[model samples]
Target: MSPLVIAGASRGVGLELARLARSGGRPVVALVRPGSDSSELRHLGVEVVAGDALSRADADRLFGSLPAGCDAVSTLSGLAGDGRRADDEGNINLVDAAAASGLTGRFLLITSIGCGEMAPYRSERAIAAFGAAVDAKTRAEEHLRGSGLAWTILRPGGLRTAPATGNGILSADPEMHGFINRADVAQLALRALRDPSTRDQAFAVVDRAEARSVNAIDPHPLLALGA
Candidate 1:
């Protein structure tokens, strides 16, 4: 099997993805930031590469230096402050690097639900803090949609650290709001890497039971909206 390259795999969903991939006997190359703690990944025997994903040259170096023919790529990068430039630039750089790699494999991105026009800000401070990140994710999604690669955009809603229940819901429209466990999200991404039916689809994920119930709530109305 070809190696899987996971950008921002130092922690959270990225780290979980690496662990799962490694346990499944798949080679994993984890991209970490300089000085970022990677003891967890190291403990899992994952190969670690250090670089910032927001820079094209750095991203190129990270991916280029890897062994050829990676089977899949996942970007789990996130933002912490009110810096639109950093978020937008990082996403764009990652997309560009993925496009340049010329690897005919699954390209999966961990984006958030309500990333574009649907992103809700309940307060001015919150809006200011996350506005840039939302725009950046939106742009990144758009780029991936048109990048001509076999892509699957997994947009998760209200990520939590709870245990996984092996169930989740996927909504195509943004009106549905719910929470999802990060572990479940990681599992979904891993599954999509090899699942042919998930290709070329951008889905908003939540707890599966919630999704089914939402689908049952005026199914025709929801279908019409998505249509």
Candidate 2:
């Protein structure tokens, strides 16, 4: 695999994904915000580029050097009160800029389960709490889907800060909902990126148990989780 360009690699699932890629002997170009510490990434030999995912100029600068048809994954998001637009503006900038760069391969996007058609399955309270973020994610998904780039959108259930259980699972059943470890999410992103069958598809993911790794529990490497 060529160097994978990951947006939102400063921390959390994005960071873990970068680690996995590096561990697998794949080069990583991690995009993070300016001023954000990249010590962890640098420690892993990742090439960290500081840029706001919501800035067109920044996005252009990052993607301009990316090779055409290289894999990219974005997990950009803002917290509840950070006053930053993440799910929407953040991802849109990366998507649009990458598309324009003509170097984007299969782009995998990570979003929450309540986004898009899965909204109805969420409780009213949950929706009310995350409604704004969900709305923004939906719009970003729409833009990516319509951007004419090969893309796969993953709407994972609640994310947890636990260690990998490897029991992560994926389903097209929008009604299916649960929580997953950030590491499991990263594993799924790796599988999906290499699977051509997942192109232009979207699905919900969650962990069924805390005993196995996502890839280990579901070993069919070519998009068999939700098949």
Candidate 3:
């Protein structure tokens, strides 16, 4: 199995993805900003590379050194109150570097709902608070869509810190909206990586039980658990 390179692996879904990869016996490399705590990643035996995804030099250096068959995933997002966001340029750097690295494997990007064609379904409050982030992520998604890499984009709804409920699911429907735990999101992403049918498609992730409004949710065959 080829190693998986995960940017923004210091925490959140990125960290969880690294954990899942390691548990499945896949070698993993985590790119985290310098000075961010990475004790857990190291504990999982993931190679922790200090680099900012926002830096082209850093992205280039990390991806350029990886073997050709390596896969990549970016859960990079912007921080509140910061003018500089890894959500846009940072992810762009990753996509460009991966394309240049001869990465023959999949590149999964974890963007949020309300991006691209799903913009209208987003809540007004969310748009007001995270409008900039959403816009940035939208640009990142566009870049990856045209980057020519085997790509899968997952747009997750409101995130929760609770443990995995094993209820999260993928829906091609743009109207799906709800909350999903980080662990479940990580699990769904890994499943997508292993299933070729999900390539080049963007899915909205949500826990159906928690969904406030959901319809026409056609779960991919590989991801449907009937939960």
Estimate every model's Cα lDDT from 0 to 1. 0.70, 0.82, 0.88
Better of 1 and 3 by lDDT: 3
Worst 10 residues of 3 by lDDT: 218-227
lDDT for each residue of candidate 1 in 29-148, tens digit (9 for 90 to 100): 887888899999998988888887766788888767655467545555566455434345676676677778775787888777667545652236545766666667778878878877
Question: In candidate 2, which residue ranges exceed 4 Å CA deviation?
Answer: 79-84, 210-227
lDDT of 1 at 196: 76
- Each prediction's number of clashing residue pairs: 3, 5, 0
Model 1 misplaced regions, further than 4 Å: 80-86, 116-129, 210-227
Model 2 C-alpha lDDT per residue in residues 1-227, reported as the tens digit of each score: 67899998979999989888898889999888878989999999999888887778998899898888688899988853567687898888888888899965888899988888877777898878988888889989999999888999988788888787877766666676678999989988888887887789887888876322223334223563335
* Greater-TM-score candidate between 2 and 3: 3
Q: Looking at model 1, report the run of 10 residues with the lowest lDDT sum.
A: 218-227
Rank the models by lDDT, top first.
Answer: 3, 2, 1
What's the lDDT for residue 154 in model 1? 78
